[model samples]
Target: MFPTLHIAEKTTGSRGSLALLRWALVVIFLWFGCMKFTSYEAMGIAPLMQNSPIMSWIPAVFGVQGASYFIGTAELVTAAALIIGTFNKMASAFGATMSCLVYAVTLTFFLSTPGVAEPTAGGFPAISAGTGQFLLKDLVLLAASACLLLASIRPADA
Candidate 1:
């Protein structure tokens, strides 16, 4: 029904868009993963990790800074697999799976961490700009990662 839709689609077809999505995810993982090594970033995430039932064990076992390092290492590995995925579908599937898991865990911060709702704004659906909004973005990332995983598993002709 839209006149320019075909032109826009042709400009960046499905494959092209998928490639862009893949690269964008790569950048996010690489950048944030690297940032995990810094004391500032480590401390910034500590409260979230501390409150999470799923993540609290990390700090207990490795200590705060050590837990950050461990997470950073995992992210770098995911990035490497994604880079290699450009050449290998199996690698792509693996990387996408990792991406899904990472984002899923991050999304849980919305439930576990305090102050997700801005109490002054009447709370509940009224999300806080800081932690709540920051974490909400992972919903998109998880969906994107799922798409990549499905594409990796699909037949070549499909």
Candidate 2:
């Protein structure tokens, strides 16, 4: 009876760990998504977007506030899906795609500029100096999202 209980306890612990991982991922998405709304200006991201060729068309079509709202909505929705574990795969894939796009845009900025210095304060360094670092960070995020997507597809028993 003691041995049997030990095995059962071990199994439960494993399941608990998996559940914890899922919740941790959800919280991560939520926190990051919320940051987009709260910290854009402080991070100097507003100006970067205003100057970005990749996003230039956004303001022309929707105006700055409208464009910000659109992007913010996307982030918020993805975060919601992650938190609720609804459409997890789709949310994760969308998140991964967004990260990739950000990486590309930042990389472009980094390459086009010269002699930019890394920011000592918060927020990303100016693209010219921080493109490589920015891309590296986003790639890591993309990998995490991809892993979550794969995990969502796996059978619970597996």
Query: Lowest summed lDDT over 10 consecutive residues: which window, candidate 1?
Result: 4-13
Candidate 2 displacement at residue 72 in angstroms: 1.5
Tens digits of lDDT, candidate 1, 1-158: 76563444332238777898899999999999999999998999899999999999999999899999999999999999999999999999999999999999999999999989989999989999998899998999998898888888888876
Report the number of clashing residue pairs per model. 0, 0
Task: Please list the residue runs of candidate 1 whose C-alpha ends up more than 4 Å from where it truly belongs after superposition.
Answer: 1-13
Angstrom error of the Cα, residue 20, model 1: value is 0.6
Candidate 1: lDDT over CA atoms? 0.91
User: Distance (Å) between predicted and true CA of 59, model 1?
Assistant: 0.6
List per-prediction Cα lDDT, in the order shown.
0.91, 0.53
Clashing pairs for model 2 are none
| Candidate 1, residue 68: lDDT | 96
lDDT of 2 by residue, 18-108 (tens): 4564566556556655655554532445555665678767766876666666666666666666655544555545554454454456555
Q: Candidate 2, which ten residues in sequence have the lowest lDDT sum?
A: 4-13
TM for every model, in the order presented, reads: 0.91, 0.53
